[model samples]
Target chain A: MKLSHKELEIQSGQFGEVRKLALEHQMQVGKFFDAQSFVEISQVHIMADTEALGLAGIEYLENLAQYPDPQKQVWVPTITDPRGSDFKSFKKIKQNKRFVDLEKRAIDAFKQLNVMMTDTCINYQVFMPPVKGEHLAFGDTGSSIYANSVLGARTNFEGGPSALAASLTGRTPMYGLHIEQNRIPNKFFNFNVRPTNFSDWGALGGIIGKQMNSYWDIPIIYGIDYKPTSDELKHFGAAMASFGSTPMFHIAGVTPEDHLAQNKNPKMNNISLSDLNNFYKSYLPKDDNLDVVVFAAPQLSLNEMRILSELLDGKKIHPKVSLLVCTPSAVKVLCDKNGISKKIENSGGIILEGVCFYNMHAREIGEANGWKRLMSNSAKIINILGGYGYETILNSMEKCVISACQGKIVK
Target chain B: MKENVYFGHIGIGEPVKGEALVADDNFSARYDLDRINGNFSRKSHKLFNQSYVNKILVLNVAKGGVATAWMFRSMKISKICPKALLLNFANPIIAQGAAHANLPLIDRFESDITKIIKSGDIIKLFPKEGKVEILNEKSTN
Candidate 1:
């Protein structure tokens, strides 16, 4: 890969150890992917949850924090994805002290490097949505997909280290999603049913995700009757990315990229309603009892918060079941102001900010709380929690709330 | 010494030799692994309950989660990780993670790596050279 004089200086340690490390990290990733040069990225969203980072990752950050040069601060406007533990609710959620301490240390290290603790996967919805054709260094799969497909921004799956490196260097290796040639759709799907709700959208996405199965697959979907809401697309894109590791998808006449996609109909596979039903049915629990009900993964948007509050209002969650509501801190403030958080909390649901359930030492929390059976509206989270020893039942948001009230899934 | 050589794309990290733990299933450190135990813990995974420590994991592809990129580094620090990863198809996350962890990972082989490699076979990786040698194979007879 070719380097600029400024990049050479950073590599030569003229800018200090932090920039040097960042450059080396980018160069390593660059050479691996055959990136010819670096592309300047406008912003970066880093997924540095403490669980993923662990003590070793945190210690690595602390080592970086030891550098005193302010010149080593992030060159771009960098924010964070959801943290592993929400400090305000970690103890209540049964997260251990070690988890909390690691979260703090990681945050401190990031702050030292001038990274904002936005702590959200839904940064596109709450904070700032990247514009069409804008290049970014985004970490979360959901964020990358949404930004790429929906908003028409460009980003590959920039992980914690890569995103942070892009932050410090203000540039990322020009490969993968950064190049325009790779954005073309290879797989086409024609759906039989029009998805009306968030769950339907998610269910459809899961089927497509399973079918696509590879990161290189860009599925251009057709036959949707109407445009989905941001929240609906959130669930859809998040589930697709989670289930398939797919980065970008195009929805006919809806997403921005669809217009740029070739007009010639790529050979399309017919996706029937039964496929969606079967996908949902596959995750259904055998037993009726519910240990927990969660409303997160991509974290809740404001509209989702409003709807959840409306459902929980004037009702009580079953004593035997625990309901968790995960949202971004910024959105939580609005939910609080709108009394959405209060309503859910008053009905026995815990509204946690900045941390999704699966990333918060899920296995340990489940063991500590004795929670083995779980239900959630997020197809992404339910798919993930299964691996963490939870028996998950994937259902619609409405069905999930009803399950919370009755203390078991309503079959 | 019987050896069958296979060529792959230039991978990350130094060359190393270890027994193969081949599976047709896709991988994600966040979705399919118990990092602390160095084992495949996802019940539905093809390699479920199998220990991956010190082995050359030959798999179909990488699936889901950007967390795997950092996870390789975290797993490496604790010494609870596969010695190398050889997948038929590689994603950006897998490549980035391999770079971060300095874990030898080669992908984009001429054929399905999982079909070529079998469990318990001795395998050696030459990352810079993009070459893999199946060092020892038991005869079918």
Candidate 2:
């Protein structure tokens, strides 16, 4: 990898030890990918949940945070993804004290390093949305895919360490999605059915993701007559990224880069209505004894919050079922101010802020609460919870709410 | 039996030698593993329920989210991580995680690594040199 004079200086410790360490790590990754040079990044989103960052990771951050050198801080605007626990509702979710303490320690460390605690996977929806062709180091797969595919920004699926490295140095190695040639469509998908609900859209993404499983696959989707909402694309991209580790995709006449699909012939696969049904069938609930129904993964947008609030109005969740509604702090604040939180809470639902369900010590919480059969509207959450020992079922928001009321699988 | 060797792109971390756990499936520390148990816990994974601790995990590709980047270090700290990773294809998340954890990882081989390597086969990995050598062919079965 070719390093610029500034990069060389950083590598030589002209900057603080923190910057040197960050640069060295970046260089190793860059060389692995054969990156040619470094590209200046405008912003970075770091994923540093306590669950992902265990004691060693937290100590690593604290060690970097203790650096007294002024240059040890992040070079560009840096933000965070969802935290491991929401302090206000950790106990409600059965997360122990140790988990909460670890979360606080991680937060303090990130603050010392000058990172904003956005605490969101839906940063593109509630936080600063990246512009077209802008360079960023986004840590969340959902965020990276949304920015790369929907907003036309350039980024790879930067993991926590790599994103933090980019933050410290204000640049990332130029490779993968940062290059133009790599973004061109290689796999094509012909969409025959238009999705009616969020889960349908997510199922669509999962079907395509299962087929285009490689990180290098750039799938171009076609046959959509209407423009899908941002929330719809959010579920689609989030599920696709979760299921396949995919970073970017394009929807003809819908997403910004559909023009790239023209004149380019790639292997074509058709996504039919039956494909979506089979996807939902694969995750069908085995029994009616539902322990929990969750609405999260990418977290809920304000519009989603409004929709959920309406669905839960005047209906009480069954005594045996626990309903968890997760959203970013920004959206949660709006929900609180507008009484959306109260409406949902009135119906026996708990709203967790600033933490996605899967990252918040999910396995431990499940064990503590004796939760086994889990239901959620988000395809991304359903796909992830399986490894956490949950018999996850995918459904629409309406069906999930109804199931929570009946305490069983409605369908 | 002949000693077989394969070359791949130069990779990250120290050279290591360990038993191989080969699978023709993609990997994700968050989605396909039970980190606390040190086993492949995802039911759909080809190596489901198999213990991966300290073995050189040979897989087809890396898949799923960026959590694996932080997860590798966490798994290493708990001493439950694979000894090294040898994949036919590696995404940035795997490369970044391996670099962060300093776990030996080499990928981008000319052929499928899972088919070339067998479970329980003793193998030596030279990550920086981009070399993998299978030892004790008798154990390949």
Candidate 1 structure quality by residue, lDDT tens digits, A1-411: 999888889889988888888889889888877899999999999998988988888998888888885765788899999988888888887889899989999999999988889999999998778999899999999999999999999999999889988998889999989888788888899989878678788878778888775788899988988878898899999999988989999988899878656749468899998887888889876668789998889899999999999999999999999999999999999998989999999999999998888889999999999998998888899888777888888888889999999988985
- Tens-digit lDDT track of model 2 for A1-411: 888999999999988788999999999999999998999999999998988888989999999989974766898999999999888998888898899999999999999988999999999998889999999999999999999999999999899999999999999999999998888888889988889999998988888888775799888898889989999999999999888888899998888887876556666788898888889899886567799999998899999999999999999999999999999999999999999999999999999999999999899999999999999989999999898899999999999999999989997
- Report, for every candidate in turn, its global Cα lDDT versus the true structure: 0.88, 0.91
Provide the TM-score of the second chain in candidate 2: 0.95
Model 1 interface CAPRI class = medium
Clashes of 1: 0
Each candidate's interface RMSD: 1.1, 1.0
**Clashing pairs in model 1, backbone N/Cα/C closer than 3 A:** none
The CAPRI quality class of candidate 2 comes to: high
DockQ of 1: 0.76
Error of 1 at A327 (Å): 0.4
TM-score of each: 0.98, 0.98
Error of 1 at A191 (Å): 1.2
RMSD of each: 1.5, 1.4
Give lDDT tens digits, candidate 1, residues B91-121: 8888888888999989888888889989888
